[model samples]
Target chain A: MPSDSTIQVRQVDRYRWLVPKQGPMRVDGLVFADRRLMADVRGDQALQQVVNVATLPGIVGHSIAMPDIHWGYGFPIGGVAAFDPDEGGVVSPGGVGYDINCGVRLLRSDLVVGDIRPKLRELMNQIMRDVPAGVGVGQRDLRLGPQDLLGVLEKGARWAVEHGFGVPADLDRIESGGALSGADTAAVSPRALERGRKQLGTVGSGNHFVEVGYVDEVYDEHAAHVMGLDLDTVTVFIHSGSRGLGHQVCTDFIDVMLRATAKYGIDLPDKQLACAPLDSDEGKLYLGAMNAAANFAFANRQVMMHGVREAIERVLGRSWTKLGLDLVYDVAHNNAKWEEHQVDGRRRKLCVHRKGATRAFPPGNAELPAAYAEIGQPVLIPGDMGRYSFVLAGTERASQETFASTCHGAGRQMSRTQAKKSVRRDGRDLRREFEEMGIEVRAASFATVAEEIPEAYKDVADVVDVVHQAGIGRKVVRLRPLGVLKG
Target chain B: MEDPLGPGVREVEHTADVGIVVEASDFEQLLHRAAVGVFALMYGKADADLGPTDLFNPLGTRVHLGASDDQGNQAGMPRPITVVGSDPAAILLKWLRELLFLHETEGLAYRRATFDVVDEERVSATVWMGPEPTPAACEFKGVTYHDLDVTPGVDGWRARVILDV
Candidate 1:
């Protein structure tokens, strides 16, 4: 057979390319990136993955990549696709990623930017110190027993809220109400259970972070107002996910599916996309385990919010309730879910795979919370600690088109190693750089600090603009970083 | 003899979808071979033989990747793989993982790879998606890198890659 090198590349526009369908590919691969980004992206193997995903069984629409697309296992990061279960479509871990429901949440404060700038360092510092970080550093040394853990897997942040991690209103702003049902702890391994026992309230390392910021700019006045954003308003952002426990769950099942492939007799272009029929016992087991981890992530973030509230109270010497540290919204980035969408003009249920992407359900969708349904789902996109983040609302355009998914954040512009090397050469102290930017910074490790320097990522503003212009999601508020806690 | 360090990528089959491990002297080389191996199973070829004139030899591998199960809802379990290797290291690991995944999912198999060095983190290879290597068995769902250990060798370069499967 002709080698993969025989694969052809066709530029479709200034920011998109086509990996033509040849060989076993079922559809063409589409990449979204400016010429500048594409040059670097093309040099990576992610394009091949995009092409490879097209060959999967029953993948509908385009196997698409966001501008932040980067090389990843099985499926490329920032990739999206939909599959039909009736057609033998398969869900691949490589498609959703390891951080089950790892995502971003934006909190809008009633306070203005100027009011907090002078106290930015203290605010950021308090949040950073209070939130548990690093790998497996438990919250107040809290541990979950089987019963408590199972309850959490089912109720998610609701459990945390009931226990005082947050209030009832917080659920109104959460995607899937902070709990994705169908979490079967039985699918989980003891190892995964052990690792997650104390980690539910902690932030895991690599790309996970919490930041404090102020609204810098607003593009769509109506949309921004609908999103509860005003110029210079203070906001807080949390980006993290299910930690080691989730990783173990995935590890627990990769083996199970390997056998399923043989039973189902499906052909695979990439092994990382291992799977069984959706109705198989193996599939059900994996789904249960994955959901449990997802619930864990939601609960973890909720407790961290509580810790942030406590820290705020400690620093400001006032109650968070009085200060008004309320959640604006939370959205998962890398995940897979069952949803109803228009397929060939019919409301068909399908498995939507959004890896490094967020669901931007348009306004009027019944799924959104009462308050936000009028504005649509809140899409929280976080930028690098040194850059700015944005709040957006889903659009009908997105729902009718790309399965209500949009790009997650500023895609990587430079490799972490390359960023490190360049910083080393330029004598840039990652810790000091954020300080100079007037953004408080804390980290679990200096290496990670150095590796995630703001320069390492593409200008997130550009990424948010793409989706906004494309009408997938409309801009709401602009969050400029004040401080960051990294892991 | 059984490979004590779990199964090396070499043990990965096209259709078994089994996860395998790959090691290299350095991060860059490890990623290089891993990428090679992932793609190797898809196009079906031994990427080792296609270096020099083929693969683009970029300088690095930097990206965050996650894998998930196919079931919708909470069933969509994702696993992350963090690797950095040059052509040889990346190609092998990449090919093997891809083969292992295919084996677990589709029950396909192919023996070799043809690698084209695109850069340090990127490689292009053709894999021969052969017929099923094993019949009436399980499929590999995904691969994950957790508490992954990659230590530099005495040669001052080393890597440890673990697949969740």
Candidate 2:
């Protein structure tokens, strides 16, 4: 048997590469990338993470890496793996990531590019004023009382609608209907609650954004129309998560899982992949708290969407309803959920961990909302601020091969320090560069804007093409930014 | 403000997040340097670029958490800080995480620390605090254990830690 040091990657097809299982790995590692993208994948330590994930207990099928994969703590950013509990499967906090339920929410509006171009700056400024952002910025106006906070933990997005943060119909368009079941508030710690109290609706720090854009192209007209997309139609994308609550949840549980890992004799290739049996007391407690954190995230996006609506209303002198601002869908990229999938021609219950990946349930999947049941789940992929973002649909091939998951975003190519240093050396005015492209930019700091320069990431178009060509996801529409608010 | 490259702390690059590699004369100094490195990442080391201050000062507005007096002593009242873990690496991770939490909730940026007791499994210190500045180059979500290490070498001590942003 070849040792992990000698692990070899063989090309399976134009868009697929396979790392045959060896060493302690229980399954193969499959990566979706074209030659050009594959070169970048091999440049980082992400491939090692994929191999490490395959060594986890009870992992089913292949440990997959999407085209946008990049080096991340514990697991590669675009890694997806599912574990079978009946086969001594384990649940890991690292698999879900520090930001539990970190995800994207898309909102479609009736206004077109022509309607918003005149007041784009005003709209962006209003959004910047309305939403609390940047490092350690918490909501001043929307502090949740203890009981209300508990309701949010228990009800997720429904709590926001019930509290008048949004409309009731918004729940229908969210993954897991905006709330996962079995969230126990008791499982959450006091420290986690304290950290999240004032941060419910704030867009906390790095890479989180609220972007205003217009649909520039529609590849699948039928699917586009179903999701309220049309040429030049204005849209808003909110990328955020459960904030400190989620981070603290993952932090609190990692320590528990570490101790449990020793208790259960679960050997791990990395300390960050620390885990316990799915049925263990430690595992159940973590799931309960994680679900609570996920709920906090769902409510967070809902609250922010409401803020965006109010910002638009203030700018346009029309109610959000009159502007036809509606939530298209919300998808959580960082999560672990119990799912049923066919394994070796037999249906088995599995816990799927998607870190920096999106769930791509195919057409006819019972989990999809009725509006999208015929098309497939709307997979929201947000690119960097300057470039274009894509809307993709789930495919059957993905369900069979990857536990129905797809890429999350345009992964980073340069380190944050490198991006900053390059920007300084080139003397590029990021604000002017963005404005030159006709995109209005409002940021919490110039340093953030510099670190997040467009060149810092891979062209998302290339990543999306790989997913489309590989039949894991299908292209629907492409959106180009008009304005962005970053923290 | 102390130099970001003050021989004890240096920034390490990560694809998606940020980290620091720290070295010092001993474990206590290693812990102090790590805190400085992390706070410097959140609030740039230069006094001119401390950026905008947050609205609330839950720590009651010390005015110079990241600043030092003419005599080279850090400001703010020194408070007790104690943390425990399985090993030195774990202890460091927990210490960094504790400082991160304090920075977020109470706006306490690290000033300095006087180690009372420090070992592989535990650390107790009298930590000086300060208010956190906003509009930082970035924000870190949490400290992670991935690839974390803390070790003693002939040249003193060394540690590496990655933070999730």
Candidate 3:
């Protein structure tokens, strides 16, 4: 929850609420939540953050929050907003968050639950060994030189593909083809570069993981069939980001933006909301650096995905190709991108920021792959490890109403300490608990597992229901974990 | 001089991340205490308190000593670090950033700190580095400036900062 809360909200309908424009807000705040979710939200200051975001200069529409909204640093988690650069729209690093491009990728396989049920433990162990995880762990064997690092910053997942990590075909399934243009390596600092050097293919600690699961249910058979998600088919979910590099990029730019905010005479509700006019040099430089960092994240996940395929190959004694492992979709939940969206019946180029949210571009959007053009983008929503995750599709209503975005995941409802304390109080052993459910578990720290107990987040089904019912997101499939690896 | 207000660090609650509340008699003490607390969050306090084996190190094992250095493994040389920022909060954030970088790169945890210079814009300190930490329970991505607070009170100085865990 936020440190402060004094905003008032009125219910707009069963699944939405409105925080009317007041104070310095340029627009009203719109939040999609049921009463139960709103009750949880009202306890936190997330509503105030919605208001805070609405106060930013050049905000095009109502500051928005999804049902999964939770308290976050500057803008609330699950927040989405777009700004018009022509109207003094400013870019704020805080909106993109510290882990730039922190995202998830789903890979579908031909293997069924029966094929890997017995060897799930071995498969998980192999992946854990192949992928370096935990705090302060880095890829000792894959350190990148300056030039190689530059390539990663420039080409993103393409660099990984060229370096023999994965096939070229995998790129098409990724958001922005796994690399955003306009990346300026010159804008990335030496510190940021050094931090990212050894972390290229490693998963850093904290809410990051590689989960092996299977499709337990399919809600929209056509959408699922188009995405190759069939009932009982196995899958791999990789959730990670650019590691230290992204953090340092955000850290470095927050300072730059702070000064720019003062220089541009932009008044902010909070210092952390520091920003610069989109056309300014500072803004452009940050965009370049942020894009580079984001590319690194795209490449990071790509490399890790390859490692998982190799791990599966080693465990099952079959080539990944024979196993029919294919990229399903990769979506970044934290990022800001320039896109053209219709506003008031006119196409206006806008910079949309999705923090703790996912882009759910409607069907027929040109950005989607041809195979998915008729089904819309596949929105990967990973729930808590113990429960289930949902796969949703973008909708026309989403593009028209929310600038094409939806809830990212099951947002946290408990603080780390609170979660840990509850676990201790119950004398629960998370590993054993998960094992009892027939799920194989491996982690760098049991403390992390305890902190991320299933109850730590709201039931993702509840959150997804709101978006689905609101017509912003269309449900496609649901996945249940067979084995999990936590960083 | 014995301080009237005890210097210490306490974990504070946040919905998604971790935070620390640090209290010290002065700015330099505040930074030192906060560093210890942050490391404690990642690595447990078991190492922070030197064991009897740590006191009698026949192998001359390198040890990182804290502000109260009375025990354990061979004392290592102090490393000098200088950081400049626009304000005290910025300085604290930068200091923490450097410490985190050292932890990620050199595996050095905070042991002790001696301030040679201090001000809102610049801070120079000679810090004792510890050996590689044990497997961390958690990893902090970076320190966040969200709702960051550094204030002087009648009792002493207090700072509250959040970590992107």
Candidate 4:
């Protein structure tokens, strides 16, 4: 039910939409989209998903949708909803999504952009070989036992660092020191555990990729300098997530949420938004499993980052340590956390749900690592293989309105089916076109290649511009792709 | 229907092999003739002689045939379910998704399936679920419509799909 249809929307800015609460909705809904981005959502169900999320119990402020809004299983891909535990808020698998903690990480190096321009082929080849690509890809030489896998899940990048994947201090640049607390290996399912055993370092198929980029522009000189990046420095961005283990954790919880939705007397518009009170058993269980998977994703990226470092070392015949290959930052797009945000003139812990959106905490927030306290959290945004990626910093306005969340990536403008059909009709040979564009492409199947065609997505620059202009996230450095390896 | 694929379907990129796509003049032929393709994909075998069981809809939308058997694997006695749908897209998607779902949830995997279809929009075909695939059987990750089409061609109706390895 639309809850009496009294929920009103008022344009707060060119890029933001407000949903005012009237009926059963506890809080209003906020959507970030400019006139250009808003056009894509006109006939889409994602907007309806935003409205549907407003009816959940204990929702705080407004149900927020980021700029890259697309219809997903439950919440819109670029959606953020905060639930208050004091009022019996809930956690839903639809909120966290199948690929739990499916996130992106950025790696910066001291190498100038011009240094590796000629050797792009060799670099892509070496990275592809070092970091195995495609479905169920694993390092045959590095299988782990149950204890080892659990340790990886619990320790995140620390596990990779312990195994000589990278130096010890790389942890300072990662989110949650590369491992979010409260990850219990025992809460993880055996199938999830087994599937993740060999997938620690592999970049799984579909939308996942490893891209080598060059700093194209510097928007914030001080922030870039603090982050050890200069205009024209080479960087590597790893975009992947917790793989199969995360998928199962979500599947396991959807069953619980489905029943919880009905038992708790919550009337919902979509089954995908099935949720239970945050204090309930199902909620706790899903949170535990989701955090475990999120930790797995963190560890997964750490392992891949280590692999990238190794490949760079092998290609250049020098130690990555000697090259100052420091990690920039990593952030998860799909997650719900207990965070203290002021609502109704009081501060309370709300379960913030950022599905396909990243938290954009402003500067001086205690969560920031000691180094980034002055500049705020490092926000990494990756675009299509054919376009440019961005590095942004959080702003105070993000705290006031959005509870510190921003768009995830270039939103999909077309369905997968439409993408495949369109790319094929354009007479564009994806592999050849990618090669001509100086990008190496690999996939388990040809269909995934077509679905991932660049034309299928909106220009990420447009999406990032809305956030940057909106003062939610500010651009720091822009990075353009030199080569990309897709799943 | 005429396709340029080879006669035998064994393996592709990695493990988890053995499946085929069939063509037809219309929806009827698409479902009716797909059984032949299913048998061909499953090492040219079938459950044609198996008795009728039941037709059920798990998702409450599509047609599904759930047939089971209490057979003793090396471990002990276990049961398996086979589901079939009329729409080739629906059937193939359901078959693959169900197989993966069972593996993830119920710890069950299917090595082979005997699929039969009915052409009508409301009528899905039949499926005889078989034992979980052994280590030797290839697992198909997913089916994709990269260059997929079901339009009438020079010969009949055809489609192209890439199976995720």
Query: Compared with the true structure, what per-residue lDDT tens digits does model 3 show for residues B1-165?
Result: 322122478778788888889998888888898888888788744222222211111122221112222233433668788999888888998999888887776656778888999987899999887764346667788888887988888988899999987
Tell me how far the alpha carbon of residue A177 in candidate 3 is from the true structure, in angstroms, after superposition.
0.3
The 0-to-1 C-alpha lDDT of every candidate, in the order given, reads 0.66, 0.87, 0.86, 0.69
Candidate chain B TM-scores, in order: 0.38, 0.77, 0.76, 0.39
How well is each residue in A278-338 modelled by candidate 2, as lDDT tens digits?
Answer: 8899988999999999999999999999999999999999999999999999999999999
Q: A1-487, model 1: which lDDT tens digit per residue? A: 0123446878876656777787788877877666776665666666777888888888877788877776666777789988888877777766777678888887776778777778766666666557765432455446688888877878889989988788999988888889988888778877667556666666666678888788888876776765667787777788878776676676557657756877889786665677776667887778778888888888888988888778777877878778778888888987788998897778877888888889999889998887777788888888887888878889998787678888898877665546545766776555556667887776654545655678788888887777776567788878888878776
Tell me which residue pairs clash in candidate 2.
none
lDDT for model 3, on a 0 to 1 scale? 0.86
List model 3 lDDT by residue over A264-357, tens digit each. 9999988878899999999999999999999999999999999999999999999999998999999999999998888878899999999999
lDDT of 4 by residue, A1-487 (tens): 0122333567887888877775666777888889877757654567767887888888888888888887664677899989998998888887877778889999888898778887777777778777765543455556678888888878888887888777778888777678877776777888677667666787776678899888889999999998877899989999888876787677567667878888989887666677899999878888888888888888889889988998899888888877778898989898888888888899989989988899888899998888899999999988887888899999999888888888889977766546645765676556667767776654434555665678777888998999998889999988988887665
In terms of TM-score, the best-performing candidate is 2
Off by over 4 Å in 1: A1-6, A9-18, B1-165
Candidate 4 residue pairs that clash: A28-A62, B16-B138, B16-B139, B17-B138, B111-B133, B117-B125
Candidate rank order under TM-score: 2, 3, 4, 1
Better model by lDDT: candidate 1 vs candidate 3: 3
**lDDT score of residue A39 within candidate 2:** 82
Candidate 2 error regions (>4 Å): A1-6, B46-77, B132-134
Q: Ten residues in a row with the worst lDDT in model 1 chain A?
A: A133-142
- Candidate 4: residue B75 Cα off by (Å): 18
Q: Tell me the deviation in Å of residue A389 in model 4.
A: 0.6
